[model samples]
Target: MTLKVGTILEGTVVNITNFGAFVDVEGKTGLVHISEVADTYVKDIRQHLKEKDKVKVKIIAIDEQGKISLSIRQAMPKSSRPVEIDWQGERNKNSGLSFEERLAKFLKESEERIQDLKHREGRRYGTASRR
Candidate 1:
């Protein structure tokens, strides 16, 4: 029943402000910061939330004075979560290239790409005069 940081709870919206919304969750209360309300820009808090509205919020901060700050952003559905990019195509787990070596390889590849684009078909480096 005690509110704790990182705890997720269902709450009712008691008030809505330009900055954020206030919710009372599990007999405890907290404020959902404006920046933490949603993933996209919110020009008006009322557009997305309203008084007496039900929402799920995640407790993010609990001050020594028991002040609780919450985030509805953290409770966003997984479908709206950030997509993690896999770099496995760049290197395997056992690749031994050092940082400097990898940088050098990257530079070499970039230079080749630029050269390829700059030159016309079959007019590559050292082959300008040839057919």
Candidate 2:
């Protein structure tokens, strides 16, 4: 099969290293970097992949030297991806409130947070101060 950029294929994990995992795709080996292993932060690639494990990977890049960069996360179907939060939609849900009302609410919440932080700090270090 002609493996081009954006091509998705199933491969076997031939090796695992601290930096990345090597996958054997149709007899060709490609490097799936630790960042490409998952959508979230990957502290350790071993936790997500193991030698001989079958994984679907996307051909993300191919350098002139013929080195292939793959991504297991990108190969996943769009429906399986995490749902994004719509900040605008959430804000619009409370559209009935006026601009001044929103500003007042925001100021009240901010002041309350500041007061809470100060209270916590006072408790942890005591209100007494040294000269």
Give the candidate number with the greatest lDDT.
2
TM-score of 1: 0.68
Off by over 4 Å in 1: 77-79, 93-105, 112-131
Would you list the C-alpha lDDT of every candidate in the order shown?
Answer: 0.86, 0.93
Model 1 lDDT per residue over 11-116, tens place: 9999888889989998777899899988888888888998999999999998888888999999877888878778995587527888898889889999999877
> Once model 2 is optimally superposed onto the true structure by TM-score, how far is the C-alpha of residue 5 displaced, in angstroms?
1.1
Give all candidate RMSDs, comma-separated: 5.3, 4.7
Q: Estimate each model's TM-score.
A: 0.68, 0.74
- Model 2 CA deviation exceeding 4 Å by range: 94-98, 109-131
TM-score of model 2 relative to the true fold? 0.74
Instruction: Please name the candidate that would achieve the greatest TM-score relative to the true structure.
Output: 2
Provide the global lDDT of candidate 2 against the true structure: 0.93
